[model samples]
Target: MQLNQRINAFVELGKLLKDLAENETIAQTILAKAEAENGWFTRENILFSLNNWAEALTQANLLQWMSKYNVELLPQESNEVKKVAIIMAGNIPLVGFHDFLSVLMTGNKVITKLSSNDKTLLPFIAAQLIEIEPRFKDYVAFTEGKLEHFDMVIATGSNNTARYFEYYFGKYPNIIRKNRNSVAILNGTETEAELKLLADDIFVYFGLGCRNVSKLYVPEGYNFEAFFKAMYHWKEIIHNHKYINNYDYNKAVYLMDSFPLLDNEFMLLKEDKGFSSPISVVFFEKYDSEESLKKEVSKHSENIQCIVSKIGIDNEIRFGETQFPKLWDYADGVDTVAFLLDS
Candidate 1:
């Protein structure tokens, strides 16, 4: 198919996913399965995750290929298609979904090894995709096997796990995921509405995903009051999740032992020298120049995923997204589109 045709196919797949969201019966069924099978993931979490994936894989994300690659797709020469192996991450909801879309949209077969933490959602979505368009089944496979058979690989995991992926999959062309996180830039200009949504960006998912904002680059003397006020309603939210609850439990003991924190009901604001990227914990820094901030951020660029603020002449940005990563935002900076096309 032509590149435009492939792009249209991706658009169709995105709509199919959105359709899945509005279909209440299927939604409930999938949510139940996702909860039962995913263990600890709630129904609302599953639905929200599915919806996020549906939104990200839109034409806007796919069009990124046109500009990024600077090439158009060629018509298929034969029915034979490449087979790509995807090693998915379970960090956030449906983290592997992007690879699935990359493989399917590129008219390639996907031999997927689902993350043990997220085994349920991908398989369920694959089954649904077959039902929505049976022909897609021929182009996909969910499996666990030796990596030699696949033409290329896209793997997501920790920096340590990435080293292992490199050792094993290095024989072939591959995309290996390493540790990464997102940061938020607050210039003290955000309105109430923006702060509210931005807080959701930081706290939602318990700051677990790579896209979760784990650090804030704020202007000097920026009032924490505005941020705290916008997030006041979520005060009761801190101790709700098991993971966050454990964090708070430990933090309380640490504080009793003389660990310092800027007190607030929803989250603890502590002065820090670094970023954790996947916790309610966030490191804060005040910057005078965009050059200096980007210089500081550049040192940890490999560890940062998205920047959730506007960019300026002195500012720089990377990773293509803030909290919501579309089909093109390959996890851990792996370029699945390039790998797929080359394979």
Candidate 2:
């Protein structure tokens, strides 16, 4: 298929997702299946993902995003298609959709190994795309076995599994992503509205995505009162059994270890230098100045995915908008489209 045809198919798929997000009956049924398969795929989180993608897949957004690249120069016919094998991560719903979209938009075929925890959603999406354009039926695939006959590979996993991916797919052109977390740089002057939005950044998807803010850099003597109060916006999230279980367990362990912790009944805040915090916990560190903090952030830039702040730092994502990444916001700052086009 041509690039325009591929783009049109995805735009139509986006509209279908928008309609599904609105149709509560269909959405609930899909959510039921998702939840049954993975307890972390809560209805709220899945819908949040769907709504974001729906907004992202507009024709204008696609064309504007594509305009940055010369995708038309890539091969269009099926015979010339480059096969891209994608190993998806299941931490959040549809985490691999962007890579999937990039491969197809570059006129490549995809051989996906679906994460067991996310088995239901992307396949359903692929089925919809195939329905919209019959040609996509040839471009999309899912395999529970060994991947073979692919020109390139894109994989996402933990630092441990990434090593395995490298050992195996190292010879092939690939994009293998490892564990990375988001951090927020906070000044004492943030407005209540912004703090409330930051709650969504931390709590949406239950802090499961790479985009979720798991760490914080706050000015010295930063009072926790306003931050804690703002976090109450997601108090209902505590009702999730799996979340409460984590909170209880982590709180108990920290108490036993005599670690200093700030607790607000649901989430735990610990003064930590670490980037990746456990579920129901957010790590925090005190910074003396933006210059020092920026240096520190740069030192560990490889471990961070998004930096949420309005502190005049470079490439910082605004508060609460970390999850709403645009089509061009490539994960790991690696351009998947460019990789595919060059492949």
Candidate 3:
């Protein structure tokens, strides 16, 4: 398919997603599909993912995102069409959709190995895309078993599984992403509105996404009351059985170890130097200076997915915006489209 044709197909897919988000009858169909496929794919989360994609796939946004790359040059660079295998992560809804889009946009065939935890949504979206542009039917396929018959691979998993991916897919051109988490830098002068927005960064997707704020960098003597108060808006999340179980378990472990914790009866905060925090918990550390904080963040750069702050650090996402990444905001600071076109 031609570049504009592919872009139009996705733009249509985006419109369909918007329709599904607004039209209750259509939304329920997708919700039922997601819920039956994975218990954690609640209706709210599925719709959130759909709505975000709908916003992202507009004609204008697609055009703007594609503007950075020379589309004509992409085909000239690699006229040999290859099949790219995508091993998706199931941490949040539609977590691997970007990779799926990247492969197709680069004029390559895609063989997806969908995560069992997120099986339904992508296939449903794929069906709609095929309906809009039948030619795409030849380009997309999903497999449940071991991946085979692909020229290259893009995989997302924990650090341990990434080692296995490296060992297995080493011969192929690949992008193997390990565990990474986002962090927020707080100067402690944030308004109530901004702090409330920061809560979205922390709690959205039930904190399952790599973009979710798993850690906080705050100046020493920063008050906890404001942060906890803002977070209280999401207090109902504790009623979620799975989340509550995590909260109860992690809290117990912290208490048993006699670790100092700031508890809001829903989430737990502990001082730590780790980037990846457990679900229902956030790690925090005191920073002495902006320069030092930047240094610390730079030290763990590879392990960080995003930095959320109003501070003008390079590539830092604004509060509540980490999860709503623009198309150019490639994961792990690695350009998937560049990889595909050049490979």
Q: Identify the candidate with maximal lDDT.
A: 2
For model 3, how does the per-residue alpha-carbon lDDT over 11-87 read when each residue is reduced to its tens digit? 99999999988774866776897787776677788888889999999989988888888776555334478899999
Stretches of candidate 3 off by over 4 Å are: 76-79
lDDT of 2 by residue, 31-80 (tens): 79998999999887888888899999999999999999985668856577
For every candidate, C-alpha RMSD to the true structure in Å: 3.4, 1.0, 1.5
Which residue pairs of candidate 3 clash?
A: none
Stretches of candidate 1 above 4 Å error? 1-13, 56-80, 145-148, 311-321, 329-334
As for candidate 1, its clashing pairs are: none
TM-score preference between candidates 1 and 2, better one:
2
**lDDT (0-100) at residue 151 of candidate 3?**
95
Taking all chains together, each candidate's TM-score versus the true structure is: 0.85, 0.98, 0.97
Off by over 4 Å in 2: 77-79
Q: What is the C-alpha lDDT of each candidate?
A: 0.70, 0.92, 0.90
Q: Per-residue CA lDDT of candidate 1, range 18-77, in tens?
A: 777667475676677766765446665566676777786667877875567745452165
